[model samples]
Target: MEEPGPVHCLLFAEVTPPLIDSHCHLDAAEFDADRAAVAAAAVAAGLATIVIPAIERANFGAVASVCREFPGCVPAYGIHPMYVDRAEPADLDALRATLAREPAVAVGEIGLDRFVEPRDDGRQAFYFVEQLKIARDLGLPVILHVRRAIDPILKQLRRIGVAGGIAHAFNGSRQQADEFIKLGFVLGFGGAMTYPRAARIRELAATLPLEAIVLETDAPDIPPAWRVGARNAPDQLPRIAAELAALRNLPVADIITATTSNVCRALPRLAH
Candidate 1:
């Protein structure tokens, strides 16, 4: 009798490969209480991997520790725009060194955020531009935190291009989305798409090409409609992907497959 091949065994076992949460802050204080439980729950919920991005030099070690503690978690290092004011020029040097020392997947959680009050645009621009240069020099992709500053973010991206990465928690126009795609970036959709009232996000989730879309939780932040006013976690990703499937009128399996592939493509190191 012929022995079953590995593919046949997997099929017979009825195992579905796990999904990816392209961007998640698993190191956030919100998970400090039951971080292990949260990671275990995410694995049980079918998540294969989660990307944890550091918001500043201070959190770099925290992010690295989380990734070490959880085999499924990977890290990205950068100085978030909001923290740039508190950042020293030396921080950029630190970021460069950390990226070299650590096996980070991308350079990110970095970008402009005009939504903040008393915005220090100059300081933000300096840090953002410098980090972008670091990413470019290292030939690494970036994970962006673009909010209301999409146009300005795009301008800087154009000025200093890096390897393709993700526009994390993307909430921009179709034109802006297209621009990101043109630059070898994929758009990240998550809890925001689960809300019916988020018409623009829902519309984009429905219409964007599957190949250009990735899924993220932005967890402990953008809770889905069902979890409104509550904490979000990586375990919520499967349902979020299901919501995306509903939006696009596609099978949940298809959404899972395509999005998992999209994220791996966006952050090639994840494929390892």
Candidate 2:
């Protein structure tokens, strides 16, 4: 009986469930020096999966290579809007062929970006529409990189509907959030939501139905408040999850479970 007392403690030991970094540029140049260590750290930090998206046709090989090195890492192949200037029409064909040849989860890091200066609206539209068509034809979801262009993104989505995907680093209004969710998309919330001044984003994170929200780091990009101006990584996700839990006034475990399920539902291939 005396020894039996300590055994009960084992049953109650706190265990954190695995998390998914829905979007992370682990293959980006920022990680070139320590990619292997970063991947290992993510696993040790309890990351079950990390989705790495390609920004252009040239990097498709890089993305695939990263995924090959890290089994837990998955790839989403697409030409990002920012890089569309350098993209040739033939790259679209390459994108199509690559998606067919590779185990790509989605056509992404794709969408509009009005924030950039001296951009060709027509060029962005051309690439966006073509990529949307590719996603539609391939019957794959897309990972959107929307910036001041959610409405246009929604318009095209309505026109050439594809399988639902995640709106990475979503900073749209509640109405926009509803629209994406209605279209079978889950909005990604990450480092931006952790900031006190990101009120609109924080409000959305707290108020949006848990099922419509997914977690992402957008690593080497949107670093959390504590790590602002530093290189972000997938290992920061658990803390991001905790921030979401605090925002929603729910337990961290609940946030993790709901967001993980949301991601799987958004990208069904990841469930495998």
Candidate 3:
């Protein structure tokens, strides 16, 4: 009798779900020269989705255009807190009008920032609140750009009431993380967690419920340790995911499945 052929094991097969780069600024000028190449590299590197957020009203068209060129990229429209100084009252109206016309995945790159000095707190609040109201009115989720202001961010969220979104590059305390989760928000983890000195962030990455965490690159910034001092991109997300798996002592496959699904949870429109 002929020997039986070898049997393949499905149990140990790789669970390489499309890795999601929940946040990336692929439309930034740094990528202007090779943007198409960068997008292709992301796909080849296993990144199935990359959410590009606009930082200012002027770039809204540019960001949307970039997303349109890549099947894997999604556009998020909003004025970042850092750019609130240049924002005019009319821009808020423009944002509202734009949201109604565009297929925006979320109102994003929006939130508080206490880290920068000489900022107009009131102006930042105005844009943030107004944008939050727009997001609520449109029944869309937001992509928060929180920095040294989690409590205030949570406060505004409670006041304006958005449809829940991702807290991009979350660097808050455990209590803050819990609050965000309670409000139906998912925390994005990226290059920061790759730093050995970022003990608190790494701990949160390891201990937080997998369902509450999503992977990101925040590209053109937040480069991983190995790529430190270099321009970051969506291609770095898979390695970042591996770092998270190592931190949690879980298989990378599980991290891929959970984080990929987590992004869809935070931005439900992406589900389509």
Highest-lDDT candidate:
2
Best-to-worst lDDT order:
2, 1, 3
Poorest 10 consecutive residues by lDDT, candidate 2: 3-12
Model 3 is weakest, by summed lDDT over 10 consecutive residues, at 4-13
Put down candidate 3 lDDT per residue, 54-92, tens digits, no spaces: 898999999878867876777789999999999998998
RMSD of each: 6.3, 8.8, 9.3
lDDT of 2 by residue, 48-159 (tens): 8888899999999999999888888888899999999999999999998888777778899899998999899999999999999999998899999999999999999999
* lDDT of each residue in 65-105, candidate 1, tens digit only: 99888877888999999888799999999999898888788
> What are the clash counts of all predictions, listed in order?
0, 0, 0
**TM-score between candidate 1 and the true structure:** 0.94
Instruction: Quantify how close model 1 is to the true structure by its C-alpha RMSD in Å.
Output: 6.3
* Candidate with more favorable, higher TM-score: 1 or 3: 1
Task: Provide the overall lDDT of each model, using Cα atoms, as 2-decimal numbers.
Answer: 0.88, 0.89, 0.87
